[model samples]
Target: MINTGKQAQLAQLKDSNAQLLKRLTARESRLNRIGMGIDAASQEAFEAFADGINGIAQGVEKTLRNERDAEAEKLTNEATAARRSSTHTSSDTAIADIMQDVKGCIEEQYLAAEKNLQVLASILGFFVDVDAVLAGCISVKDTQIFIRRSILAELSAFDCIFAAYNKIPNGSQIAVQTAHSRNGVPRDYVEDHYTQRTTKGGLLISEACIIHDEAHGMDHAPGIYTDEQISKWKTIVDAVHARGGLFFNQIIALGRVADPNFLDAQLKGPSNDVYRDREVKEMSVDDIHRFVQHFKQAAVNAMHGASFDGVEIHGANGYLIDQFIQKQTNKRTDEYSAETLKLPKEILDAVVQAIGASKTGVRMSPFSAWQGMRGDYDPVDQFEPWVRHIVSTYKDLAYVHFVDPLAGSSQEDFRKSDYLKKIVRDAGITVVSNSDLTLEMANERASKYGEAVAFGKLFISNPDLPARARNGWPLNEDYDRTSFYGGTEKGYTDYPFYK
Candidate 1:
């Protein structure tokens, strides 16, 4: 009986243990279901959150797309209107069509500018002045010359040799002014004296070659205008004036501050050194002041005898004034520091004081690296300060001339031109824009900013550029590049007229 009772107790204990194991397994299965439900809910929440974010992003993108489309449509309408209103002849239209190969070139420039505007808007918002931000394009040497020649060709197509000051009798010889002496004591009855003589019939001055150096030397090749050559130039000036043409003085290559040897050491390249060394330094504030005074006197003299409206200092073409004003080239520790630096203020102040504010004008080449100039500074760093300085200091200047960077170069670095233009316009000055601008491009640029645009090469070939542009005539190509400098007629007088 005792053994049987012990076996029953053991069985009861085993059953109880089995029951506990089953309960534990059921609890674990319930806990797993609860965990799975929580995980599913979290994943669903995440998916919904991601979907909402994507929706908002899509809306913003649509809004931007709509805005861009509207802007593009507006631009397209303006461009179309410009094309339709242009009074081009059938032949001109044909030529323009042929020139369509260059349309992409033109459009590239336009698009680059548009993109720059977008970036500026994003950074500064739409409230900024677009005009002030879009200063006119910079002028290039090739483009300027092309425009100049084109204008000349169109205007003076009939003249075989359209010489401005063409003739002066025996202009090659020098003449002296002398006074008669009274005879007296046996020592010396007649007073004998001699002096260096001035050329008879005034000097024939054509293009003004403004040298930027310590000594203000004339850079025109020797035979172009000797004391003898002056007579012929004077005649040309007089004749042109008589014909209602205005004679202006352009200062060329007038910005060598230091001695050539010094510049050679600091700057690179032998060609640069040669030019710099040859440059007699006449670009200091004091020197520029004196030069302006001389110019004033010369202008008065020229006006007294011939037709003269006014005088313009050749502040363009990377001359001394431009070098000093630009930040990259002007590494001076003295008063003429970078535009951001305060030194230029004193130098500019002196210039303003010396040359009357009304008579003076400053020219800058922010993007141009002409004559080995490397404006390595940030474009804004280089331009903003300079523009600000000009605006604040020389408020009365006639105008500011900006030489736009070359087209190919600008394409390589699109931001350069835009940055420069923005700085200039923001400064609040009348800007004369120049570049390799075709007639259409020039007109578009001018229309955009209401600024005067100068076409160098076109001006050269078509002297009547203004009229040709107005009439929409086809421009004559420049045939002789060699005759561009120090030559008599091949490129200068050979182009024929449309009529």
Candidate 2:
């Protein structure tokens, strides 16, 4: 009589478990209905979706746990009865099947939720209206409520919320040109293209413009101190301005990397370390003063003569400025020590003073030791402090361009770009992301980080990169590596305009 009672209870538990599964299935259906016509594109939408998922996930887990407990009880009773009867009939397979189904269902739901989040993030990148949706959002919970309300309200103006919070102008979204040369100035190499009509006309299709001007220390390159160099740059600047494009002149001062043969007899850096064939001389106070003067003069030259929209201080990519910034090369006890940041501070101050704060920008490659500039300490520990210091000091500058950490050998696990952004977001300066970025990446990153994108090689082969990106046209990947530097019209001006 006891065995009969136990079997009857086990049967009731199975029936109850089946009803639970049916209810879970119905809950999933209801959740799906809630998600209908709801796509998360911005931070607001994403948070809303995450909140909904979390609540539903908790409910599902609770339901599954109850079902599992009842199932376990049924199995235990069956096993006890089997042992007493000495029949040794096994219901182990059926119990195992029930457990497996529950596990699979939970796993599937979690995976589906993850996939949905990814889809929403991608959609947010390409299609969200930033103005309408992102406006006046105070908190994550509030944002969630807004997303739900927006859907139910059928707000027609909701399209405004999807606009990327981009500070850059529309036509000049992609900058093809970069600071890759010291010997060849864009003005001299591509003279014909710098005419007012040609430039303005071409810029109608182009996005942002980065004029890779000469690094300051190289004698072969145009130095801002000279009248001749200023004249050439002026011509290009006026033309680009006429076209209504934002033109930035990249000015660099190669410190340790300055070739002794090409620059001073003995190259100067923060340390006395030997690089390649030359032993770098540590800069004295006098040297720092002289360098700062040159930087200031260069800014004065570029600003006064060419009327450039802005000047990008080339402080990255293993250049002289980078040597002073990195600990490996910058091991001095003076004010210019790796910890002090006095050298870059003075140089930046001089440049900013010469050119107003609104027209001065700084570019840094914190995660890159490119051109044999390996720092002695961890890149993160070394750069994080400096970023905080610089943002505090020069909060009003135009922008801070950081070469993407993913592009270099410094560190991959840490996103130095995002880290810097977190520190500088409230500082009121734009952060530009550069190094090996394509059109799709530019758009995605701009949407994700709310920053501008700088292109290097893509701009080299395709002059009309902005138009190509907009129209989804095929780009010319063919670029002559041999004729990249110090070349005539062969590789410079010879790249045909898009037909």
Candidate 3:
């Protein structure tokens, strides 16, 4: 049943916003004369904002003008859409809950918009009344309902699946399920996988691409080391760009994680650690310098040769860098063990020096024991100084990608990433979190904590995640955990978008 009182309130709010848009548009002619020091982009953005509000008002007016029966049908459809976004919600407050999501987003965007408005208006060499300018606008509470009833969760898609990398080749020509599995470089499939999940301004981080031949831990995983590999990857990246998505290649060196099955004498790490019966040759100082150069060159391969938007240093999840940071593994007495940050700083410096800070990012899972990063390892205590160093040293770097607790870890398991997030926040830098996240939780993090939330599994199943979320389309729940890793199209590109 429709809430008649709420419906009436929405109608009034719609009319108020319409008037507000009218007032805003009335100042358009002044853009030519005394527009002050506002840049062209700001003026255009304000106009677009007015246009958006006007469109919403126009939509509401058309719906409200319908007959009572039609109005009921519209309300039913709208509420049903909201229900689909939160499939778990079965209460009467679904609409109210949806408003909270929008209100959170509105507060963030409004404050930013407000700052720009004040900054531009105050530079006029005279007193300018911002309130008088937006006087016809509806109340915040009412506006939240208005916007929620229109646009839902389409804020950002910042997920990175470990399977987000390119596929395996026919190792030893083994027979496979799909023919796509047999061929090396599933270019079309890889492109489709990424392109399907992409939305304008949304970020998609690729699977850990190998930095060098010996850096690989698994068979047939993608690498950014060669010209052919870079060329093939460029096709995938170009497809993502064509769909208005931002693509980043997360580069990694497996270190001791390389198994005896895949790597030969080339296996290397900071210490002579044995992983899965594979002996890791202790990397000499010169060897360490070579890996640094490899990362720098891989970054160059990613951004320049492959045309990727950026490169993410895979410093977490027990990779080469994490191995060096681990106290149990880094048993060196030389300058390499000066601090736990020696290898990381060298690699970060080399990559940033090669590609520039704006195009480089780093991910750290200090609390995660995913790759032997266990101990009395206090994430805040151990990683805080490194985070501080990053903030002071690499100004204007892309972002610090932090992982929340891995699956099955409690909030206090290794300590929440809230402290690390605060460190990044205090530095006024962008902090992105990629892990298991729902739309509502993601919105809370992105809006409240200023962390860009990235969904991994949800994105694997929902390619049009942003659109499906906004319109409240049902998500596909048919996922195979076995097929979650590098495999055929069973759980890959074959997952259909919302029709």
lDDT of 3 by residue, 316-363 (tens): 877888778767577787888726578889999999899878677788
Rank ordering of all candidates by TM-score, starting from the highest:
3, 2, 1
Comparing candidate 1 with candidate 3, which one achieves the higher TM-score?
A: 3
Q: Model 2 over residues 1-499: C-alpha lDDT tens digits?
A: 1233334434553444344345434533433443323333443444544543453355355546645675677778777888899666466675666556655665565555445444543543222222222221221111121222121111111111110111111111112343323333334433433331132212111211222222234433444455655676677667665543445566677777766545523577778878887787887788778777877777777778766555777788888778888887888877778888787888888888888665677778777767777555667677777678777887556667777766443444245557776575545455666666666667776555445556655665666665566567888888767755543455555566676
Which segments of candidate 1 are over 4 A away from where they belong? 1-206, 211-238, 252-307, 339-356, 411-419, 422-428
lDDT of 2: 0.54
For candidate 1, what is the TM-score?
Answer: 0.47
Candidate 2 residue spans exceeding 4 A from truth: 1-187, 192-219, 406-414
* Residue 341's lDDT in candidate 3: 79
Give the Cα lDDT of each candidate.
0.39, 0.54, 0.64
- TM-score per candidate, chains pooled: 0.47, 0.59, 0.66
The residue pairs in collision within model 3 are 158-454
Root-mean-square deviation of candidate 1? 31.4
Write the residue-wise lDDT of candidate 1 on 13-50 in tens digits.
34433443354345334323322111343334324423
